[model samples]
Target: MTAPDPTTAIDPVTAAVIQGALETIAVEMGHKLMRMSHSSIIRESEDFGAALTDPTGSQLCECRMSTPLQSGPIPGYVRHILKVVAGRGDAIRPGDVIMHNDPYGGASHGPDVAFCVPVFHQDALVGFSVTTAHHLDIGALTPGSCGIVDAVDTYAEGLQFKAIKVYEAGRRVDPVWQILEANLRAPQLVVGDMEAQIMAARIGAARFSELIETWGLAAITAAHDDLIAYSERLMREAIRALPDGEYRAVTHLDGYLDDPDPGRRDLPLVVTLRIAADTLEVDLTGTAPQLPDKPINMPFEGTVDCAIWLTVRSILLDSVTFGHIPQNAGLTRQIRIVAPKGCLANPDFPAPVIARFCPGNQLADTVMKALAQVAPDRVSAGIGNLRVASFSGLKDGRHWVHMEILEGSYGGRQGLDGMDAVDTLYANTRNNPIEDIEMHLPLRVTRYELREDAVAPGRWRGGIGTVREFTFLSDGGFSMEGDGHSHRPWGHDGGADGLTASVTLVPADGAPRALVSKIPYLKAKAGDRLVCLGPCGGGYGDPLARDPEAVLHDLREGLLGPEAAFADYGVAAMPAGLDEAATRAERGRRIVSPPS
Candidate 1:
């Protein structure tokens, strides 16, 4: 009998089952990668993403633990690979695994290596299984291949691969492997991670093939289409709920690389969000020009993808029924982005983009600020900066590179305070455990604790950031990529702004010195200590409006000090049954003459 039309609708129960199965396969693929990987970045921190896509390169299901920044760009990476293969007249067959990590070629960044494997059944390509992970090194001037804010161009950043077949016909490509092994300083660790990525893709492909067999190719394809359509419908309905209008927000970067002038900050990122009946558009027209020598530029595709993902998460996913909707290409169908060429959002070719995550996260924050005007109930205040630090040097007579992404605070919302000591916004990776760091590298965690007075006080207090101090066991080179050292996270409504991020270097015998937000490279002695104070999130409403009991609870929890409780929240402590009269008088006085 002829197969049913793949585009036709499938039953709801079967469609849900297929969706769950696809997600399960993706999760299994992630587990396999982490279990088999050698590097602590992948195995311990779990900085990786996995997904299953249809033949046309649309995502069907992604691993639940995948980073939002990494997973959203896989479909674009797949399409770019397909375009290159088609240009060269290359055939994509079963057992073929492709690898790429070129930012200009539609990758998120150079360090994030991606692998795509085609799943075939009945001698026909049905879908793809893909994985992307941040490798420890890729033959860059710096050890981690990232955190080099002063990188003048892409050449100084790291190796760039444009859609190359790493495995053909189930056989490893020796030349590609040799190139990778020769380039990276940590060849064994890097190659081991690559091998794990390949294995994950292969396992995903095999499981997907089995799924196709059990459900039949036609039924599987039908379910995929149905699920995407359902997601699109839900997204459109969510968009329709917002009042149709144009909202604009502008935020600035703190500073650029190699600029000696302390007051020299980059131009502001201007985002104009237009909300129509059932559609949304993000226009980055008046943004700053691209910086050729700094690693702050961003690719156009990446910028668009980031904007779309932020919009979906803030608007559609925030809805009650749409909270469980599948995230696929269809959800972005109603979204449009216009980022002019040579702008900070869409930079020109060869511009260093190793530190693009700073601007990318800023773009998300700008979008949130714009949406807050129309959708206050659905939006939150600004979060912390994106901080990634890399430490490298000679250890045991072998070159070593240890990279770690620090966690920051999340912004406060309507009813709840922001999450504390967690990865905020676009980042979804876990903090590297102190035990893992000490075990893998020559470093010691001296102090890791929550900053006591760093939270933004409001009716619902903002999340507090951490204060981590690391001491090198040996002389090493350190690099940092981050932002928001000067400007703090802005609160919404009548809330207060959050604390800014800061870093300091304290030598064993010398005095302490302050460090910039982005540092190219710094040499440290064996006894040197690096103190990183993360940025706290912004509050949601006025602190004076907070309940007295809530303020007392914050004081009891140590999130707010006793002095701040009396000053910010107008709450005073007394032995007599609660000083309610003094608190009321303090609040009334603040209402008449608010603190400037």
Candidate 2:
């Protein structure tokens, strides 16, 4: 940031206009990348990020379509890129696109690669335009990247590109491109995606330069600087609203349930929020120790920090209250994060973190659970964690890989019911369309719908999870990383706990068998089927406080059985409309003599 001349200070109108323009440029970059990408994960599921950052590596604007996990770590990527470049005694030049995916440095995982382009005006560095996406394969032990649950170390995950220039001074670096293509399993698709990211980042850079040209560089800088301060002020005010105290909560993840070692499964994620006047601190001191051989450990910069900040931002300055505050670095200025070294949230280097997606998300859920003590109205009940599956197989001497993000349910809150069958917390990814899956891959979606009678009862009922059944059209292998199998989403107030997730394997002709939540790459027959049952969300308020009419509505939709209506909510059902007299009597009876 440059010194602001008192005579020509930027007005609020100009600052707001500049902020909106930067956001639009980011959104455009995201659209271009998605349109030009080859893999279903990027094009269909939209698992990518595009953002603009200042020369000092502070985020200015991010694409709204991108997930929090992807965009939130961009500044860290740029900062670490600068560190790596400086350590190697190299300079960033115009037309040079640097590729980075070092988990220990800033990346969320080994699979989410970032392509960063430095923007310059008149041969002076001004900002950076970057795009990051989750690749299908990175030449790991297996064909796919998402479900590499058994990776022993970071070296086993895949290729690691740290500050490598794919394009240097307008010249193509053929060797870097060649090395990438030769290593990946799906070379054509992965390379195509990387090229698309390059073009999109370049487009973002061009748009940023255009803005600087339209409004002088000083004016642009002044506007953003003022904007950042305004955001900080908003956050500080939000912090002041909460009572000063320490709030704590604990949640668990089903880390390697099949492992014989007890330390590998049912791992705990502990969070404590310390609030004082206008500042807050998040400490992950009680989290489980790092799993040396597992890839479930989260990176402190990319995964762990993003998880905490995303939850705090969502809870404090919610859209309804703040009315679309600009997402910049200032919002996090007043928040501090502390995680004990060697814990799951902050692991040592070379601890494999390729499969950190689900556990990182559960960490976000844990933060929400902790903050709920102070901000009850601004939070939800315990959320059902998500699952990811990588489906891969060979056909006619070639390989095809697909990464699917299974949706999870949200717990009910305040006056609203929990969202049903959607990606919860920081893993905000779209579900792959059934047509896209069957048309492009050798798979069949036999069943896709809401689970029957899966409602979590409350005044505002919790969300319902979906049941997905996938059958292999040909012989293939699949692996999954997920949680919420051993634990249920915690209920709020007097609400009941939510349901748990499970997976069932049914062979072509043999008896069906139950499987753990996380699955390693395993062979399957052509006619074998896998049934995924999603966890139901936890309810908010008391189930007895729910309206009888709402219970009748769920009954009509086949979401609740007659026995459940009477037992869970104490609402008797009849053949006609509602047995109001019976419901009143039952509720009164329960109020007088509560059931354990």
Candidate 3:
């Protein structure tokens, strides 16, 4: 393919068509990766990302199936990859597959590794294709990646792949592959998943090259710029429609509740949104200081920025409101993020960050809470935070790692009840199948159900969390990283606050023990079991104003007990149904008494 003349004018219809072609290429990449993956985390949970970017690392398109945390950081990954290569006096060559996972550089953490493939047309570099996924084991100190919550420094977390070339000039880097296989616990599985990522990225690169060939270089470039501009215009108009003002919100994370140091527990996260005209600035001026030895600090470029951008995009330019706005670099052009160095959101170099996922999600929720002040109807109330547990053990003298993302609930919003047993905010990953767990590893899913009688009460009641129990069929070791245990999810308006999460470790013979939000690795017997209770979301509106019929329905469904409905919703319930006159009288008496 050759570059066409620069003077030819491209029309809008061609631009829209080109935009669609780019999106199609990304979707294809995601499908290919999932089919080729070895671990259930990527194959079934869909905790991976695929995207295309310009030479300068501006994201052109992304796979909708991937999590925001994985795909949203592609642009950052590219810029850092290019910079690292350049700083080392190296260059990105055709057929070169580069690996980079520097949390301080552009990666969310060490576990979420990225693979990049540069595309060339007629010896001229046009763009690059990239894929990122959370590997089951990145040769961390422990057997799994997600539960390395006790690392005191980056070096202790795991291997840091900084701009290493796994493939150069279309030839395999044998030594790099050998190093990875030697260090990783599950070499066959981890390396296979990684190779899958490379294949998917190469497919994207080929598709992007074909796009340049089909539309001519000149037309493709013009259309790309036009689509970016259109997205920017839509964002500007949305910002203009909002009542411009400063919105501030404060939230906390349950950091190291078992630790002796008081500074590590109950960490505060503050967000101040300065919305003026068409631009938004997220200032993290009062967030908690980074823990010198904790792995929960968030990376500024990858984790923090992704949290802020994804939250604002979902709220302001939601698909329901403006339809499918192009997901590209221009959507983030008008927004600026600022987090002071040494804070939890923008930790300094060498600070541990393996367990940054939950904190980053909380930061996103804080941004949503602040914006709810201006866009009440468009936003949900406080959201239930997620939890991760790494279940690992030995089977026939071989190691097995399984990371489970316990589902969190959604807060109630205008005209709708919160969603139940779902991943919230930036951590959008599906639950691993029970069959997959049993077939591959020596584990059993003893129980799985929704939390009974734990619903948050409101006009639109909050979503309920789930109850999951896992039993070990063999001796094993495991760890955990999570939040929402100490502080309850905050409620909006006059709604009731939500419930916190709890984890219990039950021995086959001994009594059960309560575990904190974050736990280090511990040995388990053959019959050991873990019972996880996901956090519930905060409610919305006044519970007394909730429809009497809704309260009766909840009672009939057993979502809430009769005592809860009578006390919280001020409803008088009968065996048959709601008693209208009795309910009204009860509400009036409750209003008159105003329970203290």
The Cα local distance difference test for each model comes to 0.83, 0.91, 0.91
- Model 1, 410-454: lDDT tens digits are 778888888887876777788888998998888999999999877
True lDDT of residue 89, candidate 3: 97
On the 0 to 100 scale, the lDDT of residue 577 in model 3 is 79
The 10 consecutive residues of candidate 2 with the worst lDDT sum are 1-10
Better of 1 and 3 by TM-score: 3
**Which structure among the candidates has the greatest TM-score?**
2
Give the per-residue Cα lDDT of candidate 3 at 395: 77
Question: Per-candidate TM vs. native?
Answer: 0.96, 0.98, 0.97
Residue pairs clashing in model 2 are none
For model 3 the TM-score comes to 0.97
Model 2 lDDT, residue 378, Cα: 83
Residue-pair clash count for candidate 3 = 0
Candidate 2 regions off by >4 Å? 574-576, 593-596
- lDDT per residue as tens, model 3, 221-304: 788788888899989888888888899999999999998999999999999999899999899999999997889999999999
Runs with alpha carbons beyond 4 Å of true place in candidate 1 = 1-8, 261-264, 319-321, 574-578, 593-596
lDDT of 3: 0.91
Backbone clash count for every predicted candidate, in the order shown: 0, 0, 0
Q: Per-residue lDDT of 1-596 in model 2, one digit per residue for the tens?
A: 66578765899999999989999999999999999999999998899999999997888899999999899999999999999999999999988999999999999998999999999999899999999999999999987998888888999999999989999998999999899888988888999999999999999999999999998888888888888899999999999999999999999998878889999988999999999999999999989999988999999999999999999999999989779888888899999999999999999988999989889888998999888899998888888889998999988777899999988999999988899999999989999999999999999999998999888888878888989999999999999888889999988887777899998999998999998987889888899998999988899999999989888988988888899999899999854679889999999988866587
